[model samples]
Target chain A: MTLSPTERSTIRRGAARARTDRADLHAILDAGLVCHLGVQIDGSPRVLPTAYGRDGDTLYAHGSTGARSLREAAEEPAVCVAVTLVDGIVYARSLFHHSVNYRSAVIHARARAVTDPDETWRALQVITDHLAPGSWEHARHPNRKELAATAVIAVDLGEASVKVRDGGAVDEPEDVEAATAWAGVLPLRWSWGEPEPAPDLPPGAEVPRHVRGRGVR
Target chain B: MTLSPTERSTIRRGAARARTDRADLHAILDAGLVCHLGVQIDGSPRVLPTAYGRDGDTLYAHGSTGARSLREAAEEPAVCVAVTLVDGIVYARSLFHHSVNYRSAVIHARARAVTDPDETWRALQVITDHLAPGSWEHARHPNRKELAATAVIAVDLGEASVKVRDGGAVDEPEDVEAATAWAGVLPLRWSWGEPEPAPDLPPGAEVPRHVRGRGVR
Candidate 1:
């Protein structure tokens, strides 16, 4: 299935870089841990970086009930959620062509506040599992009070655009032929470092296999 | 000098995590490579990840003149720029306490379109240098056409907020004492991989020391 890009979701600036495949959108969203949520507040636009999770075609973002951005998002006519993953820095012979090889997804929707208990519980698990792969099963579930204090907002992925630039620098023919400057890509590598056990943990507690197995990519 | 948080800049939900130090704001902004630019378009909020640079108390963001977000930001009364650096993933005995160790700065300001030639040139250099430490000097400078095709916007950092969370999980006393689940932090390590020279580069062209010396932290 292809993404049904609405007028707002269409990419006009770099139209060639926009991807229409639904799988591309899902891949970009799944790889990101945090998304910048944009919502109108007091007649101005505000963006906040918050944790998020994806379940099929719906993206879930949760925050404390007191968060003004979340509250405003729930009430706003539409909100924008953008997830960007910078894969590498593209170096061109000319400074004007310097760019970052990245995959970015921007979704526009009227986010619905999730109030159903069962859905909230599932959304919380999806969020936890996204951040820490196995934590949802190992960690204690959210208590009643904790659940009540959190606000979950769901954004549909139907109206979204995914743009990706993965290739090396695209420089002018003259600059490429001159070749006076070095041009290439410096890939950005993200990995999980050695786990630092909680300071108050009992002495002999070992880092679980789930954590240890999350080796460097 | 401490950051003078305006009514909107004041972080209400995570009050304790809100930082008042001016140095903290600069540090977080300098450490990030990309920032999420938020602006209202057609009465709806839109967020896009874009390149930015800082000069003292001002932040400059630039994009192609054809970009809609930049045009709207220049006309809007206010826009929010958010930079976030995730340091680690915090795991807690309880899902409710799980968090991310991050340093984030959000600036709210009226972005001014940079029209002065000299200021635009300097801003472009600042932005280029920020992304590729020494590229401004090594690469060919932008000519008249390139300069005219770019749109630069400057935002004052007078009204901003910085929030940081660096420690381990803060779990309930009961969960900590119970010790049924492993609790700790998985630091997110970002590094520069081996530079892949451009395929079109002359065979003998060597990677510059400035690019090679960007070693893993």
Candidate 2:
């Protein structure tokens, strides 16, 4: 469908991607395991892909204490969290006109370090499980010493917007036939492959049902 | 291999896979066609993904004069360019330890608007063709009116870093066997699918060989 400027977040050039909505936001977030943490470090901007978890309007991210991004976010006033899923490659007649149809959300807000031990402990679980469904329950819990060395930051989802692009390419009617260049989309997607067992596992550790059966969303 | 603090950037409680570097950076950027352009908007952060081109040490981005991001970047002192590529799922024995290995590049730099018509025209061609490989030659050249409304921004590529993680899950030796969870990476990759011709094309418009046989970089 044709998207107008008004529908696309008040930004004239950005298409609102009318087919997408808020629930699409949740599915995109939940279906993926990583996000790029965009923050300014020492006045320079950086985008780092890290593990993230979302609980309603707030999203939590954590990393090593010594990491530059985590340290900066903990001390800074705010940061931007961007999550994107490239659904397909939208190829057009002209090379200059190629684009990707995708679903993405950018969240801009203040982030604060979780200093309370109880909160940090809980946040870590959310983060771990966000990465894998049952891994948190099966893995070793963090000890006091290990917990003390980590940096965890939480950002509310107040100032955010989702931009998505889907469907076949939209070519100008006038140029349709004269456009001799093959003008269509080459769809792109990611999917799970056969499971590979860990090298150190005993010879016959059968693949867990939940993981072996897991498919890309 | 286990990455040490000195080798990979660290976060306090973040996982080992979160640490990434230069190889990861370029791979991510080259794998995709566009990136999120983050600039200060209304005294806060605004991010919009637009078409971009990379020439070794410099990044070029351009859009219609009607596009707000180009206009804002032209006026702002600095902007952030980020490219992120998610390769595949890294499923580990413990849910808490599950991660996605990716490559990302974040550039923090001052941006300059290309006011010269000659430069603007060429940059537009670069940006256009970057999106569509051979389109510049096929599409109608921009008329003076169209040219008058275009905006181009140049970002110097310096002081940027690339981080990446690849291969299998790293788990404690003891948990290796007891970890009943299926533990191996589902190798992920991006490739071009068969092209779909524009529905409006003439009855016998042959797909250009350059566009048809090309593989996604």
Candidate 3:
């Protein structure tokens, strides 16, 4: 299914960078670990970065029960969530043409506070799996008190937009003809380094294969 | 100078993670390539990722003149900007303790639309230098038409809060005593890859030393 852009979700500026395919939206959301949530509080807009997870078309975000942003998001009429990944820096022959190659997804929806016990449990697991591939089974689940202290909010990905810019810089014809300056892309690389064990762990506690073999692009 | 957190800038949840040092805020902003701008449009919050630059205590963000978010931010009473850098993933023996090591700065201010020509030129250079360390002097500067087509806004760093989370997971004593599960951190590494020259560049156009030696953490 393709995305049906609403009046507010449609991309206006740089329309060529917008993607309508639902798969593109899903790909951007799945690859990101954190999302910046925009919500209105006291008639002012506030943005906060928080962990997020995706299950099909619904996006899940959680925070402490006392987080004002999450609380406002649940009560507010609408909220915006943005996930961005910087792929590279596009260096052009002219300053005006310089840009960043990136993939970003923005969702606009009315956030619903997840209070259903079963759904909350599933959402938490989805979040854990998103952050650490196989930690749900390996780690001890949240106890009753812990669960009560957390707040989960779900927003549908129905009204969303995805934008992607890749490859080298797009410079002006005149600038390219001059050839006096170098122009290209400086690729940004993200990787997972060696895992450092917690200080309290006993000696020789094996690092799980799930984390050791996990690949980050 | 220390950050004097205002009523809205003060962090309530996880107050321990909040840093009062202005240097911490500057470091987080300097290390980031993009920032999420939050603005209220039509009584709903909108969050968009955009390139930004910092000159001392002033934060500048620019976009096309026709951009609606930038327009709203200039007209709105208040806006929030957030820059976040994820350092690593903190894996804990219990799901409740799982967290992310990150440095984030959130700024709340009334964005002033830059109308002065001199300030606009300076802001553009600051943004260019922030994205491509040495591109301002190497590349052709923005012409009059290019300058006219851009919109720049400046927001002070006066009402800002910085939050940082580093090191390993903080888990319960009971979970540590059990010691059945592996717990630690998976460091996230960011680096700049070899430059990919633009397709239109002539053969043997040397890459500048500034571009070659630029380091990203």
DockQ leader = 3
Clash list (residue pairs), candidate 1: none
lDDT (10s digit) by residue, model 3, range B1-217: 9998788889998899999999999999999999999998898889989999999999999999999999889998899999999999999999999999999999999999999999999999999889998999999999999999999999999999899999898999999999878899999998999989887789888889878899884
* Model 1, span B17-58: residue lDDT tens: 989999999988888999999999998889989999899999
| lDDT tens readout by residue for model 3, A1-217 | 8999888888998899999999999999889989999999888899989998999999999999998889889999899999999999999999999999999999999999999999999999989989887999999999999999999999999999899999788888999999888999999989999999887889888889988999874
Share of reference contacts kept by candidate 1: 0.90
The candidate that wins on TM-score is: 3
Full candidate order by TM-score, most accurate first = 3, 1, 2
TM-score of chain A of 2: 0.87
The DockQ-derived docking category for candidate 1 is high
Which candidate tops lDDT? Answer: 3
Candidate 2 local distance difference test against the native: 0.67
Candidate 1 reaches a DockQ of 0.88
Interface RMSD of 3: 0.8
Query: lDDT per prediction?
Result: 0.91, 0.67, 0.92
Q: Is the docking of candidate 2 incorrect, acceptable, medium or high quality?
A: acceptable
Provide the TM-score of the second chain in candidate 1.
0.97
Q: What is the DockQ for all candidates, taken in turn? A: 0.88, 0.41, 0.91
lDDT of 2 by residue, A1-217 (tens): 1222232244345545533355656677777667777666655555666788877667889877777777787677767777777766666654334567787777777888889988787788888767665656655666566687678998876555667787776765554656545566666656666776667766787777656666667
Q: Give the worst 10-residue stretch by lDDT in candidate 1 chain A.
A: A208-217
User: Which one wins by lDDT: 1 or 3?
Assistant: 3
